[model samples]
Target: MDWIDWGDAPTWLGAVFAAAAAGAAVWTLKSQRDQIDEQRRFIAEQSMNLGLERQALLAAAQERHEAQARKIRLYPQAPTYVQVVNDSDDPIYDVHCEARGMPALHAVELAPSEGVGAGILADLVQGASRPYVHRLGVGREAWFHVVTNERGAVHIRFTDAAGNKWVCDDAGGLHEAGA
Candidate 1:
């Protein structure tokens, strides 16, 4: 405390400090803006990935039952009946066959065909075929229903091996129940 000396203090020191402080502030703001932009890009990329993942899951779910449905076939073997064949390696349950837009059977008795006694077959084993006739006739009810010239005139409803219900149209289009 005896003496204080400031005779050699540099005059430009204060200005240098101010300039450095302003430069540091600008650099910090730029860095913050860059970080924000990167975060936005990352969020957008993740959102797109999530959307793609959802689409893939949906596709897989839809195809799960199609393989079994493809094995169910309806071939028109006669005017009064079509053959129902289960060509798969697994059994299907609750099969139903119906005739739509069918013509009159003038030579045979035409009535509501009880396709396997109740318009429903409890189960059809693999490689089994039945006749399904609608005009007091029969199939592979593993046969039932009549022939029609119209598109999608005959359709089959059944439960697959996995217990999933399905429909096979005359056009051979397969769809899951309630879809």
Candidate 2:
């Protein structure tokens, strides 16, 4: 049996082995690069999806906040006075009020009267009887005096500048009025 000697291999064989190793190295490098690119693309897509999801969540939260902020409440502070409060950032217009068995009340504005006084209260109550167009700004209120024999419950309606109607029923439920 003859034993093969690697040290006495042909020069061509050595060159061939060297070329094969080089080719293998290049192929491995290209495979690694392609895998890295694919991973990068996946990560980029995931990031974009996360961003869109975050925006959608933020928009939903904003809508909830706005709905909560734009509510109006009617409280009978006294037998003669009904306080109307605007709790939103937007202005409320065309204020109208009706109780169980009382005359329908309309006002120029149902806004905060800065100081509590007889004269101011009387003016506010008197103003509601006349046809007037006004706005109640944010965090403001006005008081209406009731001279009715029946003031058990009251329903108030108003609109924003954007024409969105809001109604506050005696049950304390605030909701959007119909179109």
Candidate 3:
């Protein structure tokens, strides 16, 4: 029986096999590196997309919070006067009042708990002859007297600290003007 003679194989044949194995190993390493690079790129793109989505959600939440904080209310105090109240978290400025058959009155500022009174309220009503701008702090009140009694609605205007305009009517309805 004749056995295969590995000992008779040429020395160059062993060198060829070693070279082929080395080439395969290099090819495999390169393929693995390319796959890893592609995965990294995909992960980076996904991360960027997630960040953009998070920013949009945060902006929406901020807008909703600001809307809630800007809420205002007007309340009728009595037969002679009405009160403008800030029902939100922010401060309002440049408060102005206008009623039928009466001159418009301007107020300086009003905070969250602060309010202004229009018409002949109580003794707190300031005289009509003097133009006064009042700054009502939180939970404070200021009054302006009415000189005439006419059968018409009253309207109040003001700006928030953020420069947003607000209006309120005698019907107790409050709205943002020019929004």
The pairs that clash in candidate 2 are 111-141, 112-141
Instruction: Kindly indicate the candidate among 2 and 3 with the higher lDDT.
Output: 2
lDDT of 2 by residue, 80-177 (tens): 55667778667778776666646344333444545556666666566634522356678777555554314447766788766767777656776777
**TM-scores of the models, in the given order?**
0.63, 0.52, 0.45
Cα lDDT tens digits, model 3, 6-36, are 7656766888999999999999999999999
Please state the error at residue 172 of candidate 2 in Å: 2.2
Best by lDDT: 2
* lDDT comparison, 1 vs 3, better candidate: 1
Question: What lDDT would candidate 1 get against the real structure?
Answer: 0.59
**For candidate 1, lDDT tens digit of each residue in 31-94?**
9999999999999999999999999998888776577667777655445455567666676776
Ranking by TM-score: 1, 2, 3
Any residue pairs clashing in model 3, and if so which?
113-139, 114-139, 120-146
- Of the pair 1 and 2, which is ahead by lDDT? 2
